[model samples]
Target: MKKQHFLVKQMPPEEIELEKKRAELSILEDDLALKELDLTTLQVVLEDLRRRYLRIVGVKLAQLDGIEAQIAEIIARLDPKNEEVKKEADRRRTQAQESADATGSIAAEEYEAEPFKPSEDLKQLYRDLAKKVHPDLAPDEQARERRHRFMQEVNQAYSERNEDRLRSLLNEWENRPDSVSGEGTGAELIRIIRQIARVHNRIEAISQEVENLKESELYKLKMRVDETQDESRNLLVEMAAEIDGQIEAAIARLKNISQRVEKTERSRTKQRDSKR
Candidate 1:
């Protein structure tokens, strides 16, 4: 048996570090790409799920309405002079009205469901923090530590949905010592701005795609189509389950990557500080 020839190339320290950074960036890029793709796929699946749920709810409500109508007919058959029948009809009417009210509330809640939107203050704070803590700015230990802390604060504020804290953090950054100044600051600021803009643009694009899916005739037709195709409906259910699994997996991967990145950054900062 002939062994496969393995090629080995030796690289300089600088080249090796560059390669490592490139690899890290590439992994992050791939993760983001996968997340975007998964999100798109999930959105379609979610829309299908929504349509199916709506169809089922609509059918149930229609049946309820029909039953209510039948009850009305039965009540009409009883003489108005019959006290027991009149009272029973009143009770049934009240129950039907209550059911209708509850269903309407549910539909309203579903229709009104909206994605979380950070307040203007919070957004401004995030931008400010991004400028300070951006990995590129970590040229020294102190700066790197500041960056890490700022990033932590940014993440915390975002998770808590604390617009006030975000706004305060932005204000603090503006007034803080070691704040970047001049054209250099402007360049760094632009990079941070662009990063946020990219995320927002992506989110908006996804939202529009979701809206398009909802409005699509095919989506509507699918609901009708599903009624006739048991196999297709079953397939959609399977796909939905698969999508959920993918999302959970993606989330786990992201968490692991995030922790690794943070740990690496902290270690690098400590090493740099010790040298100083």
Candidate 2:
């Protein structure tokens, strides 16, 4: 046989383009993931603060309640018309309860149904994401760890209805260098195209989440609280201190009322005057 010359052709522009995309997407995914972690941590902290604020407020209110009742009772004995104060307080309390019942409750809110029910769409999305990033599918231990973290985030985002996050993750992982290569089969190319569409969906979801979080009341409150800080004191610490002061003031008021009550315990003249 005669010696023959052979030639290898360079990859087409389309295949080259796909290879470039995989590199760019991996970098972008890393950036988005760090951002995701920050937002998630903020959200978790905000929720915990909100719950703590309500619980502390409840404790303070309960402490003040006994003092308030004592004051009202004493005032009513001293002046019969003060009974109206208790009636008015009752009416306002009822109105407040009705208003809260009309809206969703975050704290002291009772629910008749499950608080978090995954939508059918959400469940479907979650299934897709889980399959895409399942740790067992990773080719090596390092890849396995990465996928494991991705799956954790996927589970969290799914639980929290962060569909943008879930879809984004699906798009992000599909572009993984190992998963998508210039030499990928036709089936893989089709999957990549579908994932590109999912990335578009992810962008929209992220935009919505940004708007929603910025508009959230808790976010606003947190911003305000953050402004009231020094090296030694934080917002929650200051609030606790204020509550303690109020509780002390309430006890003093209760003691003053009790003293007056004792002083007048034998005064029939004050009783007759109250009746008049």
Candidate 3:
């Protein structure tokens, strides 16, 4: 066989630099997608825990508040002439009603019907959609706003574990006018550079948000509850039980106050009859 020579064309410096920037942009996009997904997942989990906490512990707290209000009402009735007592009773009643309304609004089985656990396929789709349509990747403020709205729906679908909706959103983005890209090595490089900056800013924002979430009081309590779960201790149930004890004590106090108010009324009636 005869030896043969083949030539390889060297790319221009600008072209080479553009290629490098493109590679960097690709990697950043991937990182941004993953980070956004993680942040969304954390938010969904925390929100679920919030609902569970309201349902379990908050309801009992509301009940206890109601009993306290009852006690306050009885005390006020025993001294009808005291404005302070009547005002305190009204305040307690209002507080109890608000707490009851707040707790009652959380559905008892809202999350139990279907867990928010996303399958691997669902996660993959979400990551793809996030990378393709992230608002920071938009070229202008108007485009960014549009992307923001679209991404909201995407995030909602992902949180709900709606794979079909996510797939539909991906298709919708592909067909959207903004999905088109312009070409020209120099101009493309400028665009890519701007994109890189935007993506970096977005990634940092996601990090800050995730940190804030982790530092929240609710998140701390959730972590403690999870830690106790590993040790076979149901902290939420225990919390509810603790509240139940308080509720029982409050009920007893309310009963005692009610009995006192009745006895006072009976004695006053007897005195009025004797005077007549």
Candidate 4:
């Protein structure tokens, strides 16, 4: 019975150690969950900002350009040698040019920084880091610490959307970290790297599709059509400005609409945030 007692005593210590390890793992899992949720929320905010900026700037600029084009077309149809027509065309042209410049400036201001990094380059960086610091190969505490540092670097680079920093970090990891060999570990690292690469590739493809849609012939034609309409409307205003009453009435109406739209946009934004 003395040998049986020794075995039972040995089992209790192992069980206690197992429970401690499980508790540590639970804490780690909770931390990772919180980090993931924060990351997802940030991504959503970024995407929404991009969409809002594009809609406001792109659509409005297109409308302004269309207005200018229409004014120009109307002016061209008027006989150039006639003093009234000549003066009208010159005035309308100046107004159209001013409107175009304003729209262009707004477009420039609304531009957002492009996506994190091109898929291929980002994937390459991920692969190089995975080779050096993959957790499976880092069996000891010191090695694990190094792996954690490398992973932090990877996440930082991604969050900042800094391709240059990511490339430098990957290069540093490849040069400084201990190398691993053997089929199983290397294969596992490759698999994880490939998964990251696939995600980057998909993001790049989606971005490209969006850009292509924006630049399509149909889109260009619609812009041109709108520009023509705006120009025509502007030329009519220039022509009618010769009649004082009409010019005053039109200016007043435009001012009213502009004020209303501005107020509505502000109210809508406030409502959106409140809902969130």
Candidate 5:
């Protein structure tokens, strides 16, 4: 067998070192790819959950808020001198209307389709592109910003599940002049070291973001909703039904309050007429 020294002698020391760093950078890029994928997937799932929750439970809650606001306004009218109650009534009415407007803005088509599920090919292609073009792998600030722009398109294509768009982007990147880099071996090695440091920082940032997302109340609710889904039960629908109950109760209270106010106003008018 050939000697280990012979293998070392096959290339200049700096060249060999450069190759080693390139390999390390490639591995780190792959790691960053997976982390980014996880973050994107979580974002997509959470967004879907949010829209569904708003459509179901949020609208009903808005309705309840509106009825309660009506009740508050009637109460405020009965005690016209109570500025605090009037202010509270106005605030509730504004909030209820805003909530109703927000609920109305969600497009019906957004949640009508089946859930997002990328194909194996699409996922692999995204990972490959991320490894090749992730901003964190850039050797300079300018290159990093350029890579960031390209990566945004890449991410958008991936999120939209447009394989054709991703392929087009890959082709465009390959044709770009900046895709190629060159320098003295020592300089290149230094660049690679800096890039590796940046990649580490980015990876840590992504981990922190993921942790924050997981800890959020919205995410916790999403997890509970998902669990209920697995059990063939619809948590959002159930929540909406509960809200519906509350809304009906609020409506009854509003009706009762309005009738009481009307009866009191009629009695006052009759007493004034009797005096006249």
Candidate 6:
């Protein structure tokens, strides 16, 4: 019995440790893959929601702008002393035109343009980082692709002048803290470890980004749209109805004001005839 047990070849302590590490690494690889998929899904859904929300909100704002401008015009034509109303009409017209230009339609001005000018220091930093991380300098094709992506990030951060992002990228390249893995082929394990680290970073970044997106105005608009969605209910439809009501009321007021003005003019003509 003892000889048979000896012949069974039980794993030694060193081999057991290696086996444990390998299992842990495999689990890490699986986790990294799932996180990547989640990241992609979150990004796509948030972006699509943002676009639809903005489109609906923009169209409604445009309608409001048109109605306001018309009301201002009516008041100006009805009362000669209403110079402020005339100015307001001109301003609203200019704003509406700008909104149209930006959104490729009426009333979407939520997106604002920011100025970007690369400082000399930023440019120099980018050049130094780019040279270091250049794909052509990588030892293997896989590392080369990884470096290529890293360089793209460097270029983008430089273009956007995001100093902090550039610094973080540099830090990551210098330190592969997560590269410690179970015993394996040295180069292969290093590649897997580095990939795992990057995927973890991406998962965190994407998670935070998606969370922030949830707090945005566009997200609220999307929520509103969903809440109002039914066979006979819609947010844009309700907004249009309200604005149409305001427009009708404004037109009625303008007609009444015009009648009063005409009546006053006729009264003055009668007075002039009596004086003659």
Judging by lDDT against the true structure, name the best candidate: 3
RMSD of each: 28.9, 11.3, 3.3, 20.3, 3.4, 12.9
Task: Mark the regions of model 6 whose C-alpha exceeds 4 Å error after superposition.
Answer: 1-43, 46-57, 70-90, 102-184, 230-232, 247-276
**Candidates' TM-scores?**
0.27, 0.50, 0.87, 0.27, 0.89, 0.49
Better of 3 and 6 by lDDT: 3
User: How does each model score on lDDT?
Assistant: 0.55, 0.61, 0.88, 0.51, 0.85, 0.60
Clashing pairs in 3: none
Candidate 6 least-lDDT 10 residues: 106-115
Regions of model 1 farther than 4 Å from truth: 1-18, 69-276
Per-residue accuracy of model 2 over 1-276 as CA lDDT, tens digit each: 999988989987767767766665555444444444434445555665565555545445545554565566666666656768767555545554553443325445542222244567766676666545655444456766887798888868865778788788888878877543344445444445555554445546656776787798877867766677444446655676787788789789878988887788758778888999
Candidate 4's displacement at residue 67, Å, is 33
Runs in model 2 deviating more than 4 A are 1-8, 12-14, 51-58, 65-87, 91-184, 224-229, 251-276
Task: Pick out the ten consecutive residues of candidate 3 with the lowest summed lDDT.
Answer: 107-116
lDDT at residue 163 of model 2 (Cα atoms): 79
In terms of lDDT, model 5 sits at 0.85
Which one is best on TM-score? 5
Assess candidate 1 and give its TM-score to the true structure.
0.27
List the lowest-lDDT window of 10 residues for candidate 4.
Answer: 233-242
Query: Can you list the residue pairs that collide in candidate 6?
Result: none
Worst 10 residues of 1 by lDDT: 109-118
Indicate the residue-level lDDT of 1 in model 5.
94
Tens-digit per-residue lDDT, 1-276, candidate 4: 455544433545545555555455444334433333334334433453344333444444344444544444454443345677667666766765665665565566544444333355554555455545444335345666777777777766655556788778877776784644335544544534443443345445545654664576544544453475567643223323344454355455556655666677789899999999
Error of 5 at 236 (Å): 1.1
